[model samples]
Target: TDLAAWAHQDVPFDRLVEALNPERSASRHPLFQVMLTVGQSLGSGPELGHLTTEFVVPELRIAKFDLTFGFEEHRTEDGGAAGFDICVEYATDLYDA
Candidate 1:
C-alpha cells in the first residue's frame, strides 16, 4: 500500500476525538487524520536508532508528526576532513498551530 494512504488510515479521527475528548460531541477534525499519518511514519521503530531495533513497537498517541532528512558537515579533532552527518527531526505538533 502507499505510504501516505497507510498513514491516513492508521488511526481514525473519530476514535481520536472520542479518546482525547469525551466531553465534545462535535464531528472529527481533519487535522486529526493528518497528524496520525505523520506520527505513525516518524514514530515507527528500527528506522532510526540501531540499539532499539530489537524492541517491539510502542504506543504513540499523537495528533501529527514532522520528519526532516538532511546532512551536515563535520570535522575531526586534528581538523581533518570528515564525512557528512545525517540528521532527523521527529516531532508531534498540536492541531491548534
Candidate 2:
C-alpha cells in the first residue's frame, strides 16, 4: 500500500524537502545523508531514426550527499548475467581513506 501511495503521488524531491523543512546544514543533505541506487547498466548506445547516440560518463568528483552507493548489473551477449559494477561516492571532506 505504501508503494502504491508513492506511485500515485508525484512530488518533486526539492518540494518535499521544503515541505518537510528538515534541519538545514551546509555539510549534508537536508533529509538524508546517504542514498543507494540499483539498476541495469546501459550496455550499448541506442539508435535513433537518423542519428547515432552514445553514453558518456562524465568525470565528476563532487558529491551531493555524504555517501551514495550505486549498483549496476551488466548482461552478456546472450542476455545472461555478466557481472555487477558497484561504485561508492562519498564526500572527500567528510571521509578519509
Q: Which candidate is the best by lDDT?
A: 2
True-vs-predicted CA distance for residue 76, candidate 1, Å = 7.3
Best by TM-score: 2
> Cα miss at 78, model 2 (Å)?
2.4
Candidate 1 structure quality by residue, lDDT tens digits, 1-97: 6887677676787786566665432344434322211221122346565565544545454322354444555566676656665644345452333
TM-score of each: 0.21, 0.82
Please, what are the lDDT tens digits per residue for candidate 2 over residues 12-57? 8788887888988786778888999999989768988788888887
Q: Supply candidate 2's per-residue lDDT for 16.
A: 81
Worst 10 residues of 1 by lDDT: 33-42
